[model samples]
Target: MHKKVKVKPNSKQQKIEEQPDGSLTVHLKSPPVDGKANEELIKLLSDKFDVPKSYIRIKSGLSSRQKLVEIDKEG
Candidate 1:
C-alpha cells in the first residue's frame, strides 16, 4: 500500500510513526537537503516492510515536509 509520510530529518535516531489518517512520521539523521533524508527514509521503509528498495518510491513532496510514497510489491 501507498503511504503519506512527513519527514523530520537530521534527528539523532531514525523512527517511524503511523498516524490515524494513514500517514507516517519519519525521523532520520540525514539532512533534508541534497536528497539525503529521502534516501534514508526509503531505506528505512524498505527494511521495515521487508520489501525491495525498488518497490519503494517517493511519489511527491520532494522539497516539502510532507511526502507521498508508493510501495509496489509483487510476489
Candidate 2:
C-alpha cells in the first residue's frame, strides 16, 4: 500500500493521525537529522501495519516534510 504522509519531526509525542483528505499526519519524537526521523517513521508504520520495518520504504520527499510511503503488501 502507498500512503501520502506529512511528517512532523522533533515532536514531543510520536503519533499517526489520519487526515480527512485521506492523507496521514505523522509526529515523531526523533529529530529530522541523520535520517532518524525517517527511521522512526518506518518503525511506527511497521508497528501500525503489523509489518517489518524493512517492508516500508520512503518513495519520495526524503528531505521534505511531505513524503510518499510504500508498504510491501506481501509483508
Candidate 3:
C-alpha cells in the first residue's frame, strides 16, 4: 500500500506519520522553495524505506505543504 503524507518543511526535527485519513505527516528541515523540500522529502523517504530516489514520486501538492507521494512497491 501507498502512504499519503503531509510535508512540513524547515522543521527542527524530521519525522513522518500516517494521519487518520490515511495520509502521511512529515517534518523536514529543508525550506519549501526551488523544489528543495520535495527533493529532501524524496531522499529521506527513499533512504528510510531503503529505496532509490527514482522510486519515489510526488503525486500531488508539489507546491503546498500537503503532498501525495507514491512509493514504488518494488523499490
Candidate 4:
C-alpha cells in the first residue's frame, strides 16, 4: 500500500494520525537529521501495519516533511 505521510520531526512524543483523505500525519521524536526521522517513521509504520521494517520504504521526499511511503504487507 502507498501512503502519503506528513512528518513532524522533533516532537515530544511519537504518534501517527490518519486523515480523512487517507493520508497520515506523523509526529516523531527524532530530529530530521541524518535520516533519523525517516527511520522512526518507518519503524512506526511497521508496527502499525504489523509488518517488518524492511517492508516499509520511503518512495519519495526523503529530505522533505512530506513523504510518499510504500508498505508491502504481503511480505
Candidate number with greatest lDDT? 4
Q: Write the per-residue lDDT of candidate 2 for residues 26-74, one digit (tens) a residue.
A: 9999999999999999999999989989899999999999999999969
Q: What digit string (tens of lDDT, one per residue) describes model 3 on residues 1-75?
A: 467778888899888776788777889999998999999899888988888899898888889887678899696
Error of 4 at 40 (Å): 0.5
> TM-score for each prediction?
0.92, 0.95, 0.84, 0.98
Candidate 4 local lDDT, 1-75, one digit each (tens):
999999999999999999999999999999999999999999999999999999999999999999999999887
Question: By lDDT, is 1 or 3 better?
Answer: 1
- TM-score winner between candidates 2 and 3: 2
The order by descending lDDT is 4, 2, 1, 3
Candidate 2 structure, TM-score to reference: 0.95
Q: Which parts of model 1 are misplaced by more than 4 Å?
A: none
| Alpha-carbon RMSD, each predicted model | 1.2, 0.8, 1.6, 0.5
Candidate 4 colliding pairs: none
In order, the Cα lDDT scores of the candidates are 0.89, 0.95, 0.84, 0.97
Q: Which ten residues in a row have the lowest lDDT in candidate 3?
A: 1-10
Residue 28 CA displacement from its true place in model 1, Å:
0.8
Best by TM-score: 4
Model 3 reaches what TM-score against the true structure? Answer: 0.84
Candidate 4 lDDT trough over 10 residues, lowest sum:
66-75
